[model samples]
Target: MSRGLLFRLVAIVVVSLVFPLAFTAYGLYSGARVERLALEERERQMQRVLGEVSAGLREINSGGKNGDALDREVRGVLNRTLAGYPGIRGGVFLPETQRTVIGGELKWYDYRPEVWPKEGRELFRERDPVIREALDTGEAVTRRIVMYRGEGLVHALPVTVGGEKAVAWAEEVLQPAIGQDRVLRKWAFLLTTMGFLVALASALYISGSLGRGVNRIKNGLEQLKRDLSYRLPPMPGELGQIVAAINQLAQGLMEKERLEEQLQRSARLAALGHLTAGVAHEMRNPLGIIRGTAQIMAQEYNHVPGLAEDVAVILEQADRQNRVIRELLDFARPAPPLMQEINLNAILESVLSFSRKFLEQNQVNLVTQLSPDLPQVQADGEKIKQVFLNLLLNAVEAMPTGGTITIETLATPDGVAVSFGDTGPGISPEARSHLFDPFYTTKSDGTGLGLAICHQIVTMHGGNIEVETGDRGSVFRVSLPRSPERRDAGGTLDPGD
Candidate 1:
């Protein structure tokens, strides 16, 4: 089945069983929780009300508390309570006599003095155990068959009524005619219906999504196996994240494939360089022999030596070829660096200062535009210095007659930025691309390892280096991230917009 249909099926089954069962169960449990909390709150409220009542009644009955003023307050309690729970059926207030002092018009009610339950003969009592416990503990006592037509809760409290300490008791009973329980049940049903619909919708969404996700992953993997180049296109919501992960995985695979291809190409290049080196070595011996033999022949046949100049030229050209081969071998492999944190600014200043005299003699003005708050980037300063020096040397060499060399420090969002511009001849578009290649150079006498080593240095420092050739001259830009910031950097150099 399709995931959307299966989800709907599961939801239908769950909804069929859960709603009626939970609703009925809730009806049984809700009343108990409410009753417990409400009953406790009611008991606390009653205790507070009765304390003042006891004190006032005592004063009124004995002329001891508040000088008869308490009598009015005692009457107020009777009047207020009748208004509060009018269905209270009625109660009696007694100060001295054990007889009930019924409230206004209370005698006409079925609730009478005869209805108050009392202990029988043979009971060892100053008062009934239930009343005594309630009075002594200052707590309510619940007893069976003690009051009118339901569960009755009684509280007995001590008072100084009629200048003698007496006990006052009060009772309340829960009646079934209020219809509150029915209203409560109706709300409970309505709440259950709403909750059921919400949960059903959520579950439907989740189940369908889960099934769809699993299918997408399965299909994606099948496609990936057949075509490793396949990419996971973006989707909506969390499935978008799944697609992102798939894309990331696909990208990683692609990078690995690219690395493998590079390695294969490197192997091919290594073989070719080795073969060329061997051929050069073999030719070196023969060329040396031929040059030596030709020189000897020219010396001996000087009388008929029209061919001496050509042989000498051949010898010189062979010497030049030998030198080029030697350079190529040297550049084929480079040594690992002694890496350490060193200031590039210091290195640049030192190298430029050292080369300053030679540059000035040739009318080449060396400009220093170091950053005021240039951060100390971690790098092998010696290697980086060699790179800057080589570029400078190359620029001077390129600008044979004379020109201006502008060196500047820059701060970039990506990292620390450095730029070098020379008023040398502009590089051709073709030669600029291969400028950093091992044996690539525009100058005939140049070794060509200079820019290549410079590239290696900047890359090792986790920075990038690039060159821009324009109408003026060539510019090399370097970017590097400043080291992790410290707690409170003292006046940081912000890369202001």
Candidate 2:
């Protein structure tokens, strides 16, 4: 979810950044387009100016004046019209004889090298095709004129002065429009860069804040898992509501656990009563044999052969009764634990070492993932070791053939957790509830006090033991409270305090 949030934030930021850049690009395009239209309109105005100059020449020609007078009138029209336009570089009136009739400069070449009066024939034949076409067809034609020094729009119109074919042409410069476009591009680039950086910084800040909020919620959830009594602190908005809901869930779980414990206690008492009656009945037969054997031995000592055989039977039955009594007593009342700071990993290793040969003989593979940095737990070393040993033995027994037993450890907010998993047929739901009951056993020879003792030991150490079973196998998890220095910030196992 956090990843999705980050991606969306980044997507929004990218879109935010792209918009300004795209807008700037559009502005540049629109500006260039407008500039182009304006330049074209200016060229049209220049063409119109040339038209007026051409019309004046035609009017003067209509008078039928001969030689110098008509030439002077056309020359006056060209110079007077050219003076009115700032963009007009120069102009020339080329007569059919390749002579410059009206050159804007005093000397024809003084105006410009590529100006029509200095190189009119070459301009028509090579550079300006539309000009040549206009001269041949006796019509007005326009073309773009580019020289080494500059470029412009050119218009050429065919005319007859005193019955001689002539060409009149004008040029308009475009350097100003090109320079404006360069300036506009630079501004657009600068604006885009600054906008993108601002958007990136803002996105990073917003996304980072969101990530931290999600991490806080995650940490709160872990706290709830590690300590059932823990409640989330107040948070703003929907997050606050989530915290309240989780607290309610914890309360519900606590209530369920309390009720389950009461039910388990009732069930254990009923089972214990039944087991006690059976044990009592079993002990009576052994006790009767011992009593009868003692009386017979006293009456027939040294008088009966093989009387030792009878004595051996009596001793064996006595030992058997003693073992049953001892098991019953241990289950009925367990001794207080001798607490010490012990590493759970070391205890697990010790249990594994003891069971390594047994596992190998039974073809059971063992896997351990003990944390090297696990903190020492304030627990009874022998008792915790016994707990692990019992669980390991049970896992090995669960697998009749070759299988795996995996032991792993992880640090929790309130403590450390160790898990024992067996790849064997899982416990049925009916049997699962009675797995930890004293005197209950799935095995024919088992006294059924092993896991029951383990549960008791872990409970005494201020920890818990839980079991999960499925089709694949079963897992037993033991959560032992950490030492004072390693406990959660809000909790400590300081008996002195």
Candidate 3:
């Protein structure tokens, strides 16, 4: 199964979103685990400190100390033990007297010494349950709590001092860890936001590019519907390949349509040729008799002014009709070209020489760009000359007022091409469609067989003729293969009219 553009884009978006989310979740989870481990280790350290303090109290009480001396000894032990641990405070709680003795530098009371007793009482009250639990169970207890400064850990150990049950406790402020955790959270949030933004940007860019490519294809298809010659421009990646394929398909369809039209035209011309052959043959005998009778009358009535002129008119019309009959017969059954290898340039030069007087008389300026390296082609030299001559005459006729006729010859991959460019009013689309049809002419006196004969001659020679017209003028190009053998061996000519 193939996935469409939508499916691929959706998958990309999903993956982009998921990867960052997964990474963020993992980072948070890992940070939390590390925090938990650090807290656990701190709790263990606090428990060890309480145990040492409790042992010191027992040793002091065993020395027969009591009252203020006993309290002093206990304070000395706590201060000595807790001095090594910064942010830690240790104390002993007497359940019977409801007394609390705190140790260490007591820096927590730097600002307000009078509130020490009150703050101590409140601290004791908060830990009263853990202290009682330790005294009753005779086991150590640990708890995590949030104090005025920040989060911290507390541990309590029960011991017998002077035959009285007492609780020894120590706490370490976890302000540093708390600060670190807050910073970690901020960084995580920042990274996650950045990742999400990057993902969003990437998705948007990809989607936009895809949309443009799709729209180009869509618009190109719409244009193709309206005009078969329309083609999509080149693109990049997969879309470029698609555009190339579409253009190729459009070209093929255009070619196919042209071939169909050509086939229809060929069929129509074949039928017309048969009919014209029969008609011309039937008219030939009567036409000959009329011309001969008119010639005799012209001679005999030479002395008669009006009769001689009338006979001359008859003779002229008869000759014109005879010429028409000959052209019709030629179109009806064209003779096969006497093929031979010939230089196209030489033929062009010959025709130009023959038509120089005619071109000059018509005020036509001829410009020739014949290629010296133009290859010879296998064709009838006389017929090829005729084709060139006919094209030159047509150009001269198109530009009645003085204009330029540019003739160029260039070598092709398989053969040679000759183009005749004329400055004229340009052929209209309506006339261009049937420009080579038999008996189709734009001029009042034209039999329309000139271009029709040209088409038949070029086609029989395994070549093609094409015309390009615009406001500038018209360019008629004729291309012939290097040899008939090459043309027969799958060599194809470009399509034209």
Assess candidate 2 and give its TM-score to the true structure: 0.50
Q: Using lDDT as the measure, name the better of candidate 1 and candidate 2.
A: 2
| Global lDDT scores for all candidate models | 0.61, 0.72, 0.78
Q: Write the per-residue lDDT of candidate 2 for residues 1-497, one digit (tens) a residue.
A: 66777788878978877877887888778877887787678678767777777677666643556555555676778878777775574354554435455444322543223454645445434334665687888887776666434555677778665556777777665676575675978687787878788877777787777777778878888987766767778777777788788889989997897568746654554456456646655776778777677767857795778776777777676776666666554544445567788888888888777788999999998888988889888988987888898898899889998799999998888889999999999998679767877768989878887887777677667777888888999999999888533222111111211
TM-score of each: 0.36, 0.50, 0.63
Q: What does candidate 1's lDDT look like per residue over 275-346, in tens digits?
A: 655665677787788878878888888888567887778889878877766544433433444665666688
- The best candidate by lDDT is 3
Residue 288 alpha-carbon offset, candidate 1, angstroms: 12
1 against 3, candidate with superior TM-score: 3
Mind giving the per-residue lDDT tens digits that candidate 3 earns over 424-469? 9889867887987888988887888888778777877778888888
Worst 10 residues of 1 by lDDT: 488-497
Q: What's model 1's TM-score?
A: 0.36
Clashes of 3: 0
Q: Identify the runs in model 1 with alpha carbons over 4 angstroms from their true place.
A: 1-330, 481-497
Give the 10-residue window scoring lowest on summed lDDT in candidate 3: 488-497
Clashes of each: 1, 0, 0
